[model samples]
Target: MTTISDTVALLSFLIAHPGITVAEAARATHRSPRTLVEELNGLLMCGVPPYSPSDYIGLTPLRAGDDSPIELHYASHFSRPLNFTPPEALAIKYALEHFSHGVDRETLAQISGLSAALESSLGGKAGAALRSAGRGFVLPARTERMRAMIGKLMQASEDRRVVEIEYYSSHRRRLDKRRVGVFEIIEHGAHFYVYAWCELANATRHFRLERIRSARVLDERFDRTPPERRDAGRMAPLFGGKAKERMLVRLDEHAAPDVVDDWRGVEGVKIKELPGGRAKMDMPLFNPFWALGFVMSLGEHAELLKPTSLRKELQGLLKDAIAAHA
Candidate 1:
């Protein structure tokens, strides 16, 4: 069955390609010929407000041996691409800059040209905002090994294959192996993550690409499951799990600026005034493992104040880190 999103995309495609043949339209949409006809016919009922022939969208269906091609009409509003808002323009610019790392010269030039065009369209405040947007989510330098592993996983995702990977679990502070069914790759906060179904966990899980020690695409094919049903796409980079527990920490003046910016407007997150030059923060601990690492990153300037278990866990992590360095 064709989804609403698919139907909308199909209409847009047809509008963009006037007089497109049935088979060609189906091929472009990755839908069967019959299904494409059904969707196109169904779309004919949708219109702006009134249920009349003039208001409703119409389609000319192509039959076998018909010289005239199928044409979808009555949507001049969607004939052109949508323009981006200021925030949207800024986000697109940032994403283009971030993903330009491994792109070829021609693609890079095209991106630059698109950016210039966007800036020109979104003049005044929008253009100034785009120029002043802080550098966010900088992609880290990738080794040849990481790039090769990423390439293999991309193919595995496309082929719907299973892969065996030796991964470094930061939460566990150890290396483990698992067989994962490729779902899709998502980039966020300057890092690449794979949302996959783990046979071991028997659930959809997100794995950071850089954390994989070794990867081998297996000859096994997996039963495909959509990421939406599992909520895998909603997983945050650092945190996963129930996310019911909260962590409290105190940061000195030196570190408060960055910490506050990082946690601004977060639900259940608040900061309290402190003596001298310090503040206390209370926020949800979606993943204590990730929480511990973030706290440790603040060095001596920050201290975990509440939730004794997290403090103890950080203590143990620190002891192990010291011993490892020793």
Candidate 2:
């Protein structure tokens, strides 16, 4: 099956090598000639979101059928080469530098060459940052087993295959086996999640990748469109479902500065400053456990003002901890 990633790579290849035949494009992209033709046809409907006719990535063959060279009639945006803004250039440079650390030496060389070309092309401050960016972010290495699990889930998603997995549930604090129809893998907040239809719960759930103990792709395939995709272009939040509740907290003078510095412009978060360096914050209650941990981290300087139930739970936990220590 030609995955979305493959289709994107195919589009880039077609744009760059515009007159290549189907057979030639297949050879270059490592896809079968038949699959190449199918993907080309699929691209007819593929475009930027809010996809109108003009937003589509247009292309046509120089001659009829799949035998001839292809010609691209891309959207207006693709008409010109990309011109990266200063921040964009810096982000690209930092990404390349970070990625180079995790790749093989041969791949590292290619990344280094690409970085050099970008720096040379975009001179001055951007160019200098690319050369001296020096590890702006560091990522922990993935274990071989975790990498294999991620690869398996990705293939299952592409093929619409069912998979049985041993998952460690943080809420339950135990391992459980469940069968799921894989959808897609998504990265959020520096973590990877496999969004899938869980047979046990009979609901769509995002399973954290790191917590999956093992995965086995079954021979069975799923035929129905994923619930969120049934409406096309509509999907639930990747970090679990939408928040159904809100949290209101009061921050004392000691914690006010940190809260403002950290969440000044974050969406769904509202902060009202008061006299004497205090502030009231209102935000979505995505997870109670996370809220408890966050409030605990802030110690006595932060207080949960609303959601009486959560406030009670926090008091109980604090009492238990104090009693245990005593």
Candidate 3:
């Protein structure tokens, strides 16, 4: 099935090469002629919000057959693309730079080249932001194994195959084998997760790529459709299932800025400032392991105040950690 990204890319190509034949367009897009024609027909129904007929992409073929040349009548409307504001440019530039950290050298060079092209072409406050020397975010470099695993899983997902994965379940603190009907891979915070139907859990689950010890795609096929896209404003990226519990935490002055910045646009995240630069953060707890790691990362600056059971568990973890050090 053609995704929105695929359709948009095809539209962009059509806009660039008007009156292109179906055969040539199919070759250029790496799609079969029949698939290209179907996608073009689907585009006939696509448009921005408040979608009047004029707002829809207009396509007209020169003849009645699939082999005929096609024309995009309203191509002029999309000829002028939107410009990035300064902040938008800076955000993208910074993200690109940070993304360069874990990629192969050839990919890194391409990213740098793209950054330079954007910097030189933009020319203004936006351009300056792209040209800025400092990358605003930092992340540890990823191993080649992690990169390969992600790629393999992505291909498996596209092929609608069942994959056998040896995954490390944090809650179980052990590696276990699972048969998964892979859907889509998504990046949330610093990690990549495969959203899939898990036979082991008998439900849909997100498997963190880094924690997957190994994976092998099975010859068996899956009939499951990909999940519908969640609304970004209401959902947390890392948590796919409905949250069954809530937790409250108190943050010291030093941690408040980072917490507020990270959770700013996410719905159901409430942060209220207390006196002396401190704050209270109340959020849904999807996974105890994730919550534990998050609070532990904050160290002394953050305190988990609610859910006495979890607090005791945190205390036990601290004790174990201290014992290991001793």
Candidate 4:
């Protein structure tokens, strides 16, 4: 969904460069061409008349001899706290506003104190909701300096150079300096993490970027694995385990859409509409316990049509749960 800020940013871009094409806009904004077109359509909803055709593409002034609706003074109003492109910033803001309340408290807390500007703009209700949902949890404010430091760390990681950092680990309650061989930046839920080999620890560890008090790039460099190898390592499971099994299941018509959407991450998952208002799906199981929990959440709408062992296992679990409740 397009936010007011997204619409404003696009309008600002168009007003700045009057005769730019969709492809050009996409490149400038770091957004997909299709997305830029969609954002332009949304601007049309707000009474901005933009012109785009196969040959010539640009936004014309709504009426001649009028100043652009977007003002330079108001530009900062649409600017996001994070280094996200307009659409991504808007999406994250929207999610924090709407979907965060029901999520885990720790997760909500991590996002809550990320930006003071965001908190103030969200106003009382949203702020109160976040605090209420995330009781007894607090996150350190992410200031502009911290963001800048993190950007530098990211660059160092890409260059495969050592980074010296003054870091504060809340759990440890001490500030320390160390050089790190950076591996990857991981976004777990709402938090940003640097997973790297700590020189002090001589082991891989996850460090929250927000907790770094200071950072500097070191002159030393190291040869890192190629992109393909790095990607494969990232894809590997955290826990030692055998390869996941694949299974097939059937869903009732009432459950088809939910199943399809939920199983989208499972590789090779296919859903086919069946007779008598049923749908069949093939799914990959990373861990049977996790898979069973997900399938059981669907209740009676889902049925295991194949893999009799899995069906029997789920049945036994269900029986045990009922017995425990009884």
Quantify all predictions' global Cα lDDT against the true fold.
0.75, 0.75, 0.78, 0.61
**What is the RMSD of candidate 4?**
13.3
Candidate 4 per-residue lDDT over residues 33-141, each given as its tens digit: 6676666644433322342232222344233223333222223333433233434445556566543433344445666666445545554555544333432333445
Between candidates 1 and 3, the one scoring higher on lDDT is 3
lDDT of 1 by residue, 40-62 (tens): 77777788866667777877855
TM of each candidate vs. truth: 0.62, 0.60, 0.62, 0.36
Model 4 spans > 4 angstroms off: 1-185, 188-228, 231-244, 264-267
Model 3, position 74, has a per-residue lDDT of: 56
- Residue 125 of model 1 has an lDDT of 68
**Superior candidate under lDDT, 1 versus 4:** 1
User: Model 3, 251-295: lDDT tens per residue?
Assistant: 999998889788876666778989988999998876788788889
Clashes of 2: 0
Give the Å shift of residue 81 in candidate 2: 9.8
